[model samples]
Target: MMTSKNLLELFTQTRSDSEKICQPLQTEDYVVQPIVDVSPPKWHLGHTTWFFEEFLLAPNFPGYQRFHEQYAYVFNSYYESIGKRVVRTDRGNLSRPSVQEVYEYRKHVTKLMQELISKHWNKDWNPVLEIGIHHEKQHQELLLTDIKYILGNNPLQPIYGAVSNEVLIENSEREFIEIKDGIYHIGHNSESFCYDNELPRHRVFLEPYAISSTLVTNGEWLEFMDDGGYSNTLLWHTEGWDWVKKNDIISPMYWFKNENGIWSQYLLSGSQAIDPKAAVTHISYYEAFAYAQWKGLRLPTEFEWEVAQSKINHGNRWEWTESAYLPYPNYQKPDGALGEYNGKFMVNQKVLRGSSIATPANHARLTYRNFFHAPLRWQFTSLRLAKSL
Candidate 1:
């Protein structure tokens, strides 16, 4: 079992690291829209703070101080039952909160959180706090990915962190590997804390299938573009094309070539040569589906997504699948606010299995689910090619 003091230190340390991620951003770099999928850097910071405020402070801290009353309305995110939050699309307009104020807001929340943990003289101080800490870690990853997308969009191509995208190239071209499927216990085993959506430990049946040995690479995606994957109507679904047209997408996001036609991608390390071997960065489910269709293969379903990942490394990109995000059978929400954690997110989203580069490694599992609106390719996302056997 996770000890209380250790959990407290871990929570504080993780929360502090969230601030570390923001230390590299200049105020203007905080808010830029290359695409709708990214949030402002400031918004990401405050929202994570607000998460701690709402879930942990509101419920746990009896004397919790309101950092700024507007943040409740400003940062309440997707929790309809919680009341009206700042409108989803308008979070970028919160110039009043100023970057410094948001940092102070974070400080106020952290001071109280640490004080609360010091008072945890009872058994109630167990998994709920652990859950809150990991939950914040998810936001930490999102902050990094969202900022990368936001920076990638700027015509100026702003840099967010000193980190370079030049991590040693894993082999760029991936080979296909077959997976013989069978019954598997899929979901959190309750050995450590997990999100509610990964619960009720269900049995799933998977047919024999094959998954790509590596994520689809930039070289292959460029082939799709060269093959007219985007312009071809027959390759895209109705909604996918509508999304393509709405965004005026000719190529995958964040891809640009200089007059020299050398493919360079905006990466965490700033713009770098597009690695033919690197996993293609910004293709949507629609785009991924079109590419898969073009290849005469299908995207894996969630069950198959889980089955295939049950075969490999722990965290990488949240592997995209053909499955829509939905409630599982017997998927009852846990009592109280924890119910709102994932249950409310089932609508209008797609299920992504596995973890992404931004996700914390220790916290991910085969059962862990990631979801995003269909057109969202900004998250550290990629697809695993699958075929029916």
Candidate 2:
């Protein structure tokens, strides 16, 4: 249950986290995305503010007035039933609002949300507040990923995060563990706030199968490179092959080669030699699938992945599954706009269970569903090998 004070503190802190990340950017960099894939920093800040206002404020506050009626249209993301929204492709074009104005707007919305939280003051709304905070957290990550994608394209090669990602790991081996098949239930089980797709647990069938004890590391993937993994069409799905060729991709998104043929990958702080112990990241399902096929393996279905996860530390990397993103059995969405959280995304996305380094600690769970389009590789994503024994 949420006391008004606790909910207000959370809202303030989460909003502060977003602002802290934006502190590194120059005002010009905030508006650098010439394409839709990179939302202006200003937009990311205000859009999250818009979420709280739309979902929590207007519904509960008797005298609520929209900060800007134009903002409601400019920021509504894919909620067609909510009426006309700003065109997705043109979001980066709204440079007129200025980054400072967005922060002011954030302050305005935060003030209203604090007032509403106090007035309504119920435990029921606590779940709503919790989910909204995490939703903003998810956006915090996307904001970084998208900004990196945009900056990586710049000729300047600007650095966004100053902290080094240097590390030493005690475990470097990729051990494989086998699980005996049985009926199992998967999805959220009153653990906390969850998306609709992770609801109403269901059963699944499986054979005796083995999954890699750890994520496939940069060392192992390098061997695939040595074996011409990219050239071998037999290792790829038809769609995957096309995507690879179209992008001219020969390695993960962050990889580059020197004139001397030394391979390296960019970390948050700067570029570094690919570590054998670190997970192979920035990979799409196509890449994970093709790599598995090359090694006479396969990606597990969501249930098989979930069942295996119950026994392991949901750490290191998010494992891609063969399952398309969909709703679970007997799933009932939460009422109102919160219902928009997950149930609406059941189609066209692939499920990636487990967690990645970028995922916040304590948020990962066996039933947690992470998803993306099959060909997209802009995330800290990788997979484990699953094989039928």
Candidate 3:
């Protein structure tokens, strides 16, 4: 547990980080939602603020007043227990709240939160507050990805930031690390902050399996494409094949062929030559599955993924897995609105492990489970190959 003062500092920093992510955006950049999976930048700013107000401030703080009574209906996301919310598809159409008003809403909520912590601290409230901070960090990543989609999808091809020349690793050798068959303990086991879905640490049996030492690179994916990976339906699942045909997806999202007949990818900075050595990213679960099938390999089950995580490179991009998102044995949701957080979304979603480059450094953990629908490809998602021995 963190001291109230330390938590306060953390709270302040977490809130400020969201604003920092938006610094590069023009006012116009904050309002467009190119797709339903992406939320407007300004809406992200308000929705995160609204989380604290709705969860922490209204119930716990004395004399807490809402910045706007109707903001709840506008910002609520997927919490049916909270109240009705604006439909997701229409989020981009909301312009009346205005960016300036949303900033004020954040300030109003943040001030009360800080004041409540200073005057009165409750141990019970600590977990709720921690979840809110982590939730904002989740949106911080979304803010950047959404911003990229907003700009990347634009015909003008505007730049969001300068090309980041990060020296990740010089060695890109491909090797498979072998894990012997055994029962391994998986899921979050610590007392530290973790989402409920990662809890109830359980045992899972695994057969001998070998996992790639590194992520699949753009060069490797291109080879799959060169060999007509897209046209071959046998490599894809039934739903995945339909998705491929319906969307006409030939390569990863944001990939394009220039008039000069060269492949390039859009980045936050601008469109640039695809660095073949960099880990291939922005792929959906369907694509990752097909790529694994093409190589005569398989994606690791979540248990296999957790077992081999320490030996492989992660946090460069979110690695999709073959496992479905489901509750562990004897899993139960807590007794209130907080229970609604992770438990409800455990169906109809595929599990993704690891983290992305856009993920906040403090936010990534070995036990973290990120999930998305198989067809959603707008996030910074990637893949690694694995197979049972």
Highest-lDDT candidate: 3
Candidate 3, pairs of clashing residues: none
Model 1 off-target regions past 4 Å? 31-36, 58-62, 162-168, 172-175
The TM-scores, one per candidate, come to 0.91, 0.92, 0.97
* Candidate 2 clash pair list: none
> What does the lDDT read for residue 216 in candidate 1?
76
Worst 10 residues of 2 by lDDT: 163-172
What lDDT score belongs to each candidate, Candidate 1 first? 0.76, 0.77, 0.88
lDDT of 3: 0.88
lDDT (tens digit, per residue) of candidate 3 on 1-389: 88889789889999999999999888988899888999999999999999999998999888877889999999998888889999999899999699989988988888889998888779789988899999999999899888888999999989887634321332767899999999999989877788888878999999999999898888999999999999999999999999999989999999999888889988887787778887787899999999999999999998999999889877777889999999988788977878899999999999999877778857888999999999987888888899889
Roughly what TM-score does model 1 have, to 2 decimal places?
Answer: 0.91
lDDT at position 371, candidate 1: 88
Better of 2 and 3 by lDDT: 3
Rank candidates, lDDT, best first: 3, 2, 1
